[model samples]
Target: MLGELWGTGNLFRLALPDTFLGYFLLLIDIIFLAAILLHFSRKTSFNSIFEKWQWVLGLSLAGFITSQLLPIPLPFTNQSLTPFSVFPLLLAASFLNPLAVLIVGAATGLGQSLGQTNQLFDVFHFAFTGLLAALLLQQPFIGRLYHFLRHPIVSGSISMILPAFLLGLSTLVISEAGFSLAALDQSLYTSNNALLLFLFEGFINGVLVLIILKWLPNLRPRQTLIPSPTQRSLRRQLIGNFLAFSIFITIVVMAVVFNLSISVSRRLVLNQMAHNAAIASSELPDFQSELERLVDAFDNTTLFTSSNPVEAEVSLEQIYNSSLLYNQLIVVNKELTISAQYAPGEPEKLQLSEEEKLALNAVFTTNDRKIVTKNSSSVEGLSFIVPVMDDGETVVAVIGRVTQLSINNLIVGIQGVTTDGVGFIVNEEGQVIAHPDPTMLNAYWQDEENGRSLSIETNGIKNGAYQFYESKSNTRQLVYYLQEDHDHKWTVVVSTPYAVVLDLSLDIGRPLLIILLVVVIASFIQLTYQSQGITEPITEMVTASKTMAAGGNWTPSIHAQRDDEIGQLSQAFSQMQRSMKKRLNDLSLLLNVSSDVSTNIDL
Candidate 1:
């Protein structure tokens, strides 16, 4: 309490270096005030201003002593507790007028300053805590607090929590700011422990204040002239508190619901996008099977066995014309030279390039198919080569075809539908194989670009979704991807601008907003009904009362129809007005009788 700060681990300590001097000064102040209080003990007038000062001073002194002697340790902190010393000062402020509160604050601040290193300015910071509490007590909202405290259900719990929160809030702000200004090395507490400690302290002190208020009714703050304790309405207090709490809860619920809606929307969109991408990728043809069919056809043909080149060329042309696998077909001899060829507006016979010859040799020796890619300025094509056996083991000829491959063919169904959305595919070689924009085909991208990239491997693409900023488009996009299952050679990706996903969230939000609007309208209508009920009759009664007081022959128009407090008040007012009128009439009659008697005596 008095000797320790809140935090631990090199961060918590009393600010004053000279602990002995600080405690000594604090003790001397307490002793001095105590001595003065004892010396002045006499049969003084109970309600005198002098007596009030003595009480305030005595309370401050007791607070200082309490802070030193009965410090309660907080649960989570080491030697950290609020010096309930400050609580007595709060008690003084609560039970006294502004001038008395100010005096008590000064005395309390002086006593607290002794324990602080910044003796000169710490007094003001300590004084501010009481000052702020005093100000809050004077506010109209506090009238509701008083009524709320009177209720048993909340009295035990809220009375402690509310004051704890307020006092802790002020204490934290002042302590931190003061320490910062003094350039002291200290921490308030570990994380939120300080708040917890303050809360505990407030709970204890709140119980103390309640006890005092229950037993010592005379110590309560004197009521002010405007809307004082006598004028405070229980209904108004309850309604006001309900309105404030309801609004707070509504705002919190709205925020929670909004976040949950957006989260659900985002999750649904991602799942749908990924599903669509998987379907698109599944539609891709099995290139390996297509190549195998072409190989089987050439192996069964008798054209390759013909000795005449003319016959072989004619037969190859017919085969190529009928086939769906290739755009061009070439028959290579054992020497890896093209003996026969079939193509559109091209050479009938062509020489194999060094890479093609190696592929041809590989096909012949292994008796297996070989695939090679042709990349040129004109077109991108794939060639498949298979050994053509004459009978059992003789590799008489090799059949090869160059098929033009289009990346756009991979994603054909959906295009140009979404302005800010695109679907594309990446091959194992880290190249964009299939894209909405044909120009991106065969273009290689770095592993990481603009904060996103495809998962690439040597054999094929490893599918996964990712996000990135498209610099040219200047937008953030949500991406979903899936790799083709047949060969795992290409990954299909669907990307849409992030705003599109947010728009999906708005779809759900619009209805909620409308519902909130409807609720607000309903609340407004109810508030109007309730407010009118309170204000109208009060206004009429006030007018009638003023008229009667001014000697006007105004009859009370306020009806006591409802079986409620206001109705009862109206009936009471009417009864009182009638009584006043009857008394006035009786006094007038007596005055008339006296004047007549006096006249008769004079005659």
Candidate 2:
């Protein structure tokens, strides 16, 4: 927590290094190029060899403009593209070639830079998504993913996620490059604290892009190219999406499960601190009760007074030997003279605190006074004071023990219960008061230096107060705390960074992820088949249609056998050819008859 509290941290990037940045942007370009060369090579006129390029330019400009002008901005939010990007990319991807997409992607990247987070790191997403969709939509397998996921919007918005992830990863990599240690951490997101951010963005943007892609069919230029998301395609899309999603989700489950395992290191430390804190906290009440009982025992003793001068003074040695719970006892006359003193040590050498002396004086200042006080020992133990009374209702000397707040026995008991994870207690100021970590007592209440202490002022600790803070310095540790005003109302916090306590989600998620992965793979494979085989025929028909246009009359050259997309293309081509030929022949016959009749009937 040495960093700023209110905003994003080193997660922010100052500048981008080109070597990494280049790959991200280049990917977009290549995808664009593929779309242009393979799908929609622009053709203008017999002489304008490069007229198609104009569409590319138009789309690029459109992308730039939309990115710059996207109307809304989300909070603490990092976005790769804008809501307006949908409108333009939609228009461009639907109408322009791959080349246009690549160029447009560049423009979109630029726009997002200007209008969005603007960090050099932020552009990776802008570049990624722009290129990803451009290249990926051109892919049969990926396209199949689009269909199976039941998310066309994903196709539409993949532009947002890829770049966002790229940006996030880029920012993380670049910022962390110099630190050899952090790079070695197995928990990438945990070490970086960006796992949730990336996963969330990926999921949400994934869904959006999926939805948009799904919607593209009705909006495409070639109605033939867009297949109906009929039951079959839908089913395949569902399966593919399920599988891809499942893989990542499984990873997530693993993280959660691993997060809870105390064996990992951090959770173990936190639990110990919490347990110790609890012991120290709970011990105060027990000590208080003991002191109160002693006070009562002495208060009821109407044996001696200042006037009687403790007429029945008992021997100090006898009193000391007779008492089992007390370490020492003293009997004093009203003249402030000690008549007898029992000794755990040399009674003549025993001393009391100023506060304790004052409490005693308060009892002496008035008649029949009784007082209880606690004192801190400079070396060991605490001190308690209670004034004795006489039958005449007169005040006598005050006496009590010094070791009142010890928790050695309590700590031992707590340690026995400390099984998988340890627990401890933190004082109001985040100090490690009583810890399984013996070295921890009286320490500050922070996982990181100054963090807990600093926060205590802002976060007051009342009776039964609880809080948690992850160590920024130690990423794996989670400080779990429960403040219970149990008797003493101490803040009993249990720190368990491990998920063993709340990891039922992993149990549920593991199987779900597996099932999802299997389904997604199946769907993706099916989509690949559909694009390569089912839709291949239609694509071929398109090729044939081009060949027909290149030739003279349009004839049924398309040949397909299946009843799927390709077969439909062949049948359509055949029908169009028949209709055109019939019309052509009829026109020729009518023209010939008219010409002959005109000559024969010439006036």
TM-scores of the models, in the given order?
0.45, 0.41
lDDT, candidate 2, residue 246? 64
lDDT of every predicted structure (CA atoms): 0.57, 0.48
Question: Which runs of model 1 end up more than 4 angstroms from their true locations?
Answer: 1-261, 291-323, 328-342, 345-377, 381-407, 414-420, 444-468, 484-487, 548-554, 583-603
lDDT of 2 by residue, 1-603 (tens): 113221223333233444554456546545655564455444423233245566566766776665545243333222222335534554454444455555566566665555444444343344445545654444333245435433334455444445534554544444333332232231343323333333444445455544555676554433233443443454455554555576677677666654554133343344455456556556657655665665555533545343343333343334434444356565655565555555555535455555445656666666433433232433223234555645545456646453322434444444442354455555445655455554555555544332232122223434222223333433222344445554653455444333332343345455755675687677667766655665556566667677767766565666676686557767878888788788978998999999999999995
Q: What is the lDDT for 486 in model 2? A: 43
Candidate 1, which ten residues in sequence have the lowest lDDT sum?
181-190
Best-matching candidate per lDDT: 1
User: Candidate 1 lDDT, tens digit per residue, 73-175?
Assistant: 5443344454464567567656555445545655555554444223433343344445455545544333565555442223323323333343333333334
